[model samples]
Target: MSTLVAERQLVADACRVLAARGLADGFLGHVSLRVDDERLLVRCRGPQERGLRWTTPEDVHLVTLDGEPGDDGELGEWAPPNELPLHAEVLRTRPEVSAVVHAHPPAVVTADLAGLAVRPVVGAFDMPGTKLAAGGVPVYPRGVLVRDRRLAAEMVAAMGNRPVVLLRGHGLTSAGASVPEAVLHALSVDRLARLELAVVSAGGTLVDLPAEDMAELPDLGAGFNHATAWRHELANLP
Candidate 1:
């Protein structure tokens, strides 16, 4: 298959996976796969129903690394999300990131709104490398438009090497070496976010990872169960 065809297929699969999982409520979230220099394939934003599982290649717009829409210009029927810049910046800064997924999962959103510091706990999938970027996930205060060029630059600077970042009052940004890995990162955060909220709700003292556990967890690495998870989510799709 051509690189463009492969990219389109990857992005379509990503959207179906995310939407089925309820991570992306209708048109609420976004997903993209790297194409090549200065471009990526993103699902065009608009008119999607909740749990949409099939997005055509036409639905995936080839966008610039700067998040500019491609030569086809804007899709007459759809547009890129206001957050396109966030995805663009992530790919630019983290060359290892082949795919990016962002979603407003309830648990994560709750923690963000509650002003809780959601840190990684010692677990099979909770690795320090997944959480801390070269500069760390800087919280861009909510006000900037999702596509604001300045915000895109800040996102790149902030997400340096991390697999994931949290946008205050917005959502989580997860990236990976492949489309599947990015989706897995999103699930990992959603699971962790639920635990964080539970910890806070119960007023139970939450424990941070000790040095030994931190070292061990990375090796165990909660391998992403994309196929199983995707199947489960799709079955439950509304």
Candidate 2:
């Protein structure tokens, strides 16, 4: 109905999509939507709520860029993720970013640990992979959890102008102007990571697309294929 309501629903849906796609594992990831220049709505989970697979709109909490609750007394028993600084600082610094997703996809973490580069091997068969290589995904090179501003600031610095950043042996952080865009980027990163690992494991030599070829691929404009993915995952939600 309202813009805020829509954004909140988007954030919730993004979490479900993350769970459905296996990008998140048992309460280990978070998604946030920028409500404005000063505030954002992020998925908050208590100890009892152990997974993102069943997250609903009620699980979404509103907090300021400084990581303060929208209504101090309203949060009640809900607690924001410890990595709030990751979302807060990114949204604060990147005005163009309206959504952020921090996820621990196994494929991504594995690839990083093996020192494998996620390249554009499949071309158009994988839109997200193509886009990632085109944009030059950066790695944060830190294996620790981003629980404070200093670490978060380092992550943001490593991210620079990139939409996605690999957190060494940790995970990944994806940002976009919308929930769909961010979610899709996260999914794409995982897909690319998986593909890279598969190739290496199979003893196949990996060949990346040339810079000129990468430029020829179309951008993932707007939400790209996120809407289609959302519908498919939503339909299958338990």
Candidate 3:
């Protein structure tokens, strides 16, 4: 397969993994892979498609940074997510970002609703979670659907240089240099949210890992163990 074809498959697999991992609800979430500085491959809702859990390469579509479909006109009757601006604006602003994921994981949404923030209380047991805490995951503080350029720009401003941004009571948006990296970040955020809720339910006060202790941890950077995590998630697909 060509590079575009391969990237399309990656986006499709990411959609499946997102739904299987409970980070996505039916056709609610969307994943996109930057094809170039000007365009990206994204999952669009097909006329007959029911959910992202079973998304295939055909479900993926190519669109410009401005959310216009490519010349191939392959989208047909399918329509990109209303949040296309979410992906478009981020890719346009962040040169290092090549993949973006937007999903509504229940744990994350609930954590935001309860005013619980994800922190580094679990040590190194969860590398992504630990990294997220150290790097600082910002919350957008808004619960509305990002449907317009203005809303997306607001989210982009809130996200700043962070890899992940939590949309209060709505969902999350994660960006990375590759599809797996973006997916992993989304998964990490959900896990961290779930961990936070578990601690609170047990009546335990969250004590973030000391800054000194966090400073001692190694920097694994983005896309850490992406291949392994992607393979594990794909293996679990039915």
Candidate 4:
């Protein structure tokens, strides 16, 4: 298959994984892949539905680095996420990035409101099959919308080479060379966020992960492990 065609499927499949985990929540989050150096294929924003197992490549839209929806709009004629600005902005600023995944997982969002932060826990929060947010995922100070260019720039600056950025009072933003890699970063961010919550809950402090542990963290998947997480969320779906 062409790179573009494969990218569309990858993007769609990634969304299903997020929906299954209750991450996307209808239309709350978005996932995008850089099919070209200057363009991205992302989920079109429409109805906010969950448990998406039927998304097709047609559901993906090709957009520019400047956030302009592509010409052949019919590929996924649907409107892209309002946060497309954020995605496009990141891709423009970070040339190393090829995919971006933004999600509002409850645990991570709750941790943010609780004044919690993600820090290096195992050698910089590295885990097996997980893309540890190197340099740590810094939570943006509150009050900045995802589309705010200044805020997005600051977040990118903080992210540096790490794969994720935590937006205070909002959610998580992760980037990878491929869509799957980006998804891996997102999943790892959630896991680390959960770990931080657990540590604080037990009256423990979140200390930085030693360099050794950071080097040991695994790269499980590019946030593609939705089936496992989806099954767990089945009982909690409201």
Candidate 5:
């Protein structure tokens, strides 16, 4: 397959993984990748509109960072997600980010509303996840549909240089260097949220991992953290 074809497949597969992992519901949520400085491969809604669970390559289309269709100038009846701007502005500003995953994991929303922030609370449960939480996750304090440039820009500004942003009363947006890494970030955060919920619901308190243990977490590199983990996600997909 050509590079474009590969990227489209990646986006579609990521969408399925999101739904399979319970991060998205119905036709909500999206996955996108920067194709170049000017264009990107994103999951658009086909005429069938079967939702993210049924996403396939045909559901993925090419659009510019400015939200225009590909060089073909048309995508027929297919329409990009209403939150296209959420993906566009991020790609426009973050040169280091090649992929973006926006998801609506229910536990994450609950955790945020209950004032449970995402912190490095576990030590050996997950290594990469622990490191990611240590870096801090910012929250975009709005639940509005980010369908315009101005709103999208605001979300990006709130996200800053962090790997993820918790959309208050809405969903979460996670960024990474590839399709798998981005999805993994969302998965890790969702796990943390679920744990927080379980702990709090059982009359426990949220606590961060000891500084000494956090300092000992190793940098396992992308090989094990992204590539290998991605294969596992794909393998587990129903």
Candidate 6:
């Protein structure tokens, strides 16, 4: 496939993966890829509007940073997602990032609202995720729809240099150099959230892995963490 075709496929598949994994409920979430300095390929709610689980490559639209469709007007009856700024601002601010995923994972929202921030609760459960949690996940205090530049800037400020940022009661925004990495970050964070809630609900206390064990965790590199894990997601998608 040509690069554009592949990118659209990636965006659509990312949404499908997120939906199948319980990260995005209904048709409210979006995934985006920086097409260049000025344009992007983002998931759009096409006329069929079957929601994320039913997303197909045709549902992806090529649009400018301002959320305008490409000259062909391929957008047709659909429009870019309302929270385009959430992805636009991130791509504009973080030059190294090429993809962004905004998802409303139920466990993530519930855990954050209950004041259970993801922590380094275990070393072996997920090495990369444990490291991410140990680095401190930042939370954006607002729950309002981030549909404007200013609100998105605020979210970026809270995100800082982290791979993921939680948007209070809303959801999370994850950034990465590729679509797979971005989606993986969301999956990892959500997994941590679910584990946190499960432990707490079972009346167990979260104990951080000892500093030495954390220090011993090896960096498995992107090949294993992103490519391999993403393959697993695709294989399991129904």
Provide the TM-score for each candidate, comma-separated. Answer: 0.78, 0.91, 0.94, 0.76, 0.97, 0.97
Greater-lDDT candidate between 2 and 6: 6
Error of 4 at 56 (Å): 3.3
Of candidates 3 and 2, the better by TM-score = 3
Candidate 1 Cα errors over 4 Å, as ranges: 1-3, 46-57, 66-76, 125-138, 218-238
Clashes of each: 1, 0, 0, 21, 0, 0
- RMSD per candidate (Å) reads 4.0, 2.3, 1.8, 5.0, 1.4, 1.4
Instruction: Give the Å shift of residue 78 in candidate 3.
Output: 1.2
Q: What is the lDDT of candidate 3?
A: 0.87
Task: After the best TM-score superposition of candidate 4, give how far the Cα of residue 78 lies from its true spot, in angstroms.
Answer: 0.7
List runs of model 4 lying over 4 Å from the truth: 1-3, 47-54, 73-77, 122-134, 148-151, 205-238
Q: Candidate 2: where is the Cα deviation over 4 Å?
A: 1-3, 219-224
Cα lDDT for residue 150, candidate 4: 69
lDDT of 4 by residue, 1-238 (tens): 2347877877887777676666666557788987677788888754443334445566777877666765554444367777777788788888888889888888888887897766566542345323344455666666466676766677777666677777777787888877766775676677777878998899998777566765666545534344444344434333
Q: For candidate 1, lDDT tens digit of each residue in 99-218?
A: 889887777777767876556653555453334421234455563456766777776565556677777777878888878778877776666667878887888876766657655543
Residue 137's lDDT in candidate 3 = 86
Error of 3 at 104 (Å): 0.2
Q: Could you tell me the C-alpha RMSD of candidate 2 in Å?
A: 2.3
lDDT tens digits by residue: candidate 2, 141-238? 88988989999999999999899999998889999988887887888888888988998999998888776877677755545476676666678766
lDDT of 6 by residue, 1-238 (tens): 1348888898999999999999997888999999889999999878879899999888898889998876575678888999999999999999999999999999999999999988989887799899999998999999999999999999999999999999998999999999999999899899999999999999999888999998898988888988899999999998
What lDDT tens digits, residue by residue, belong to model 3 across residues 1-238?
Answer: 2347888888999999999999996779999998878888999988898898989888899888777876466578878889999999999889999999999999999998898887778777776678676778899998999998899999999999999999998999999988888998899889988999999999999888887877777756544567777788889987
- In candidate 5, where is summed lDDT lowest over 10 consecutive residues? 1-10
Candidate topping lDDT: 6
